[model samples]
Target: MEERKQLKKTLKPHWVWAIAFGSAVGWGAFVLPGDWMAAAGPLGVILGFSIGALLMIVIAVSYGQLIQKLPVSGGEFAYAYFGFGRYHASFCGWFLTLGYMCIVALNASALALLIKFVLPGVAMQGLMYNIAGWDVYGGEVLVACIALITFAYLNIRGTSISGFMQFIFCLTLIAGLSLLVIAMILHPSSSFSNVQPLFNPEIGAVSAVIAIIAISPWAYVGFDNIPQAAEEFNFSPKKAFKLIVIALLCAAATYSLTIIATAVAMPWQSLIAQETVWGTGLVVENAYGTIGVILLSISLAMGIFTGLNGFYVATSRLLFAMGRAEILPRVFAKLHPKYETPFVGIIFTCLITLSAPFFGRQALLWVVDMSAIGVTIAYFYCCAVAYRLFSWTSTADTDVIVSPAKKAMTLLGLISSTGFFLLLVVPGSPGFLGTPSWIALFIWIAIGFVFFMMKRKDFARIPKEKLDYNIFGKTLESESISSNTTKKEA
Candidate 1:
C-alpha cells in the first residue's frame, strides 16, 4: 500500500520566531517606558518593567495555549469567536486592527525623529524646508511618510521579503543596544544609585503601582502577537511552545539590560525631563561623543522601520482574516495574484497611518491610551477564554491536559490582565485618563457591533459547520452541524 504524506502549508519557523521578536522590540523599548518613568522616575522604570513583563508572560502563555487549539490567522478575532461569540469576535478584530494601524503610524513617526537626530542640518532643514515650507521638527514626518510608502510596497510584495527585512533590522537594533550597553559599562560615573530608591512613599505605593501598570502595559503589548504567527510555525505545537518561552526569556534579559544601561549612563531625572523621548541617542552621545549619536540614530531609524514593518504585516493579516470571514468588505480580502499578499489592506493601512504627523502630543497620547485599553481588553478576553478551555476539557484528553504549573501560569495571567483592565478604567491617574480612552474604545466597539448586526443575515448564511469549526474546534463539529441544521429549519 502506498501512503500519501500530508502537504503542509506554513511559513518557515525562523521567520515566525523573528516576527515574534521583532514585533515586541518596537518603539515600546525606547518610548513606552519613558512615559512611565516620567511619572514614576527610576524606581518607576523598574516597577513598570517588572510588572509589565509578568503580565505579558501570562498573556503570552494563554495565547500560546489558544494557538495550539485553534492555530488560526486572525489572532484575537479568531480566539474571541470561539471563546465568546460573533459580537465579541468582531469587536476584538476591529479594535486590534485599529491598534496595529496606530502602532505602525507611531513607529513611523519615531523613525522620523531618529533621522532628524542623526543628520540634524540636512535631514531637518533641507527636507522639512522643501516639503512643508517650515523648519518644523526637521521634516521627519515627510521622511516617515516616504518610508511608510516604501515599506508598504515591499510588504505588499510578500511575507518572505518582509521577514528578511525584519531580520536585518533586528540585527541593526541589537548592534545599537550593544553600543549603548558598552558605553554605560565603560563610563566611570554610570551607577545603580540613580535607580535605587531611598524611601518608598507610603501613601503613593498603590497608586504608583496602578499608574505604572497602565503605562507599562505598552512595553509588553506585542508578546500576544506570537499566536498570530501560528499559521507560520513549521514545528509541532510543543516545540513552538518551547520556542516562545525561550524567546520571551531572551527578550526579558534584553530589556532588563537595556534599562540598566540607560539608568546607569544618564541621571534618572535628566533622562525623564528630556523633551525628546528617544533617549538612546542621548545615551550614546553622552558616552562616545558625536560618533555615538550617529550610530545610535542609524540604529534607531532601522529599529523603527522594522517595527513599522511588523505592524503593517500583522494588521494586514487581521484585515485579510476579517474579509475572509465576511466581517469586513470582501474587497479587503483581495490578494495580489503576483505577490500573494493583501494589497488593498496594505494600501489602506499605510494611508491611514500617514495621519500620525497631524496628531500633536495630546492627540498622540489619546491614541496610545485608547489603543492600550483596547489591547488590554483583548488580553482579558483571551485569558478568560483560556480559563474556560482549561476547565471544560476532559481530564483524560491528551490535547487538553492541564498541569498544575500551567494552570498557575494561566491564573496569574488572568489576574494580571483583569487588574490592568481595571487600572486603565480608573480616572485621574498618572499616565492615563479613565473616561477619554474608554469612551473612544466604546465608540469603536459600537461601530463594529452595528456592522455585525447589519451583516447578521449574511453571517447566518455561512454554514454553521464552518462557523463552529472556525470558532470552537473540530471537536464540536457534530454539535455545530446539528445547531446549524436546526437554525436553518427555524
Candidate 2:
C-alpha cells in the first residue's frame, strides 16, 4: 500500500487541460490547413472539421465513461485490460504505444521543419546523409535531438514541471491564435474572392470529409492524454470525465479556427502556389507583414513544444503502465524515487524519437499516418470494452454498469472508429495511406506480432499480483454513493 502511493497525484485541473488540449494541438494545426484547403475547399474544410468534431465527441464520451469507471494511468490500455485479459490488453497497449511514439517522432521532425522554414539556411545548410530521397541535415538532426532530450528531461523531472511548461505554451498558443484570427479579419489584403470553389471539385464533399476523418486521430490526439495521466490527477473521477470533454471541445476549436485563419490570411490559390510547403507562416506574414510572421513563428514553436511535451508525458505513462504489468519490460516501470517519474520509459521513448528526424519530415509524416491506424485500432478496442462492460454485470472486480445513454454513445464511438479504420485502409478510398506508409505500417505490425508471440508464455502465466493494478476498485465507491442517494430519497 505504501509503495502504491509512490506516484504523486499533483496534477490540477488546468494542468489536465494543458496536457490534453496541448497534445491534441500538434504540428497538424500549423502544416495541415493548406492540405485541408487543397483536399477540401474552405467550405469543405469547415464541414470536414465539423463532422470530425462530432466523431470526437462520441469517442470522448466513450472515454469519459470508461475513465470514470476506472481512472487509471494506462488510458486505452487500461480500458482493454478490463475488457479483455492480459494478452489482448498487451496487444492494445503495444499498438497504442506505436501511435504515441510516432507522434513524439512527428513532433521532433516538425520542430526541425518549423525551424527550417522560419530561419532559412539554418536547417538545410549543414548537409548530412540522405535517406529515402529526403536530405538529412546535421542542423535539422541537432534541433530534433535537442527537443527530444529536453522534453524527456522535463518529464523525467515530474508531471508538475512538465504540466507547468505545457500551460504556459498552451496559453501563448491560444492568445496567438486569437490575435491571428483578428488580424486576418482586419487586414484587407486577403480577398474574400480567394475562397472561390467552396467545395473541392476534385475530391467532392464526401471524400473531403472522409479525408479529414482519416486524419482525425492526429488532429485530435491530445484529449486522451488526460486519461493517460488519470492516476496523476488530484481530482474526482466525475471532474476528470468533465475535463476530458472540455479538452475535446477546446481541441476542436483550435483546429477549426486554425483552418479558418489560414484561409483568411491569404488567397488559397496564392498560398498553395508558394515553393515552400509552409503555407501557414506565409499566410500570416501576408496578413500583417514580417512582424506578424515572427509572432506566428513564435506561436508555432510554442504549439509544437506543447505537443512534444504532452506526448512525452503520455508515452512515458503508457510505457510505465505496460512495464508494471510486465507487458514489455519491468525496467520501464522503474520510477525515480525522488521525482516519482518514469525515467526509464521516458529515456527509451526519447531514444526512439531521436531516430525519426533522420528520415526527415515526409518520412515522419508516414509514421504519423501509420500511427493514426494504430490509434484507431486502440479506439475500437476501447469502445468494445465499453460495450462489453455496459452489458455485463461485473468486470475486473467492479460492479459498475454503463448507463443506457453512455451505452448509446459507446456504440456511436465504435461505429465512428470502424468507419475511420475502413476509410484509412480501404483501397480506392480517399483517406487511404499511401504505399510508403502502408509498408511502414506492415513492418510495425510484424514487429509487434513477434513481440507478442515471444511474450506469450509470460502472458499466459501472469502472476496474480500484476492483475491487482488493473482493477481500479472504483465501482464500490460508486455503488456506495448510489445506495446513499437511494436511502436519502426513501
Q: Pick the candidate with the highest lDDT.
A: 2
Q: How close is candidate 2 to the true structure, as a TM-score?
A: 0.92
lDDT by residue (tens digit), candidate 2, 4-62 = 32357888889888888888887678777887888878778777777787788788877
Evaluated against the true structure, the overall lDDT of model 1 is: 0.66
- Residue-by-residue lDDT tens digits, candidate 1, 274-321: 865466557767778897677656656665776788778788877776
Predicted structure 2: lDDT? 0.78
Per model, how many backbone clashes are there?
A: 2, 1
Each prediction's whole-model lDDT (CA): 0.66, 0.78
Off by over 4 Å in 2: 1-6, 391-402, 470-490
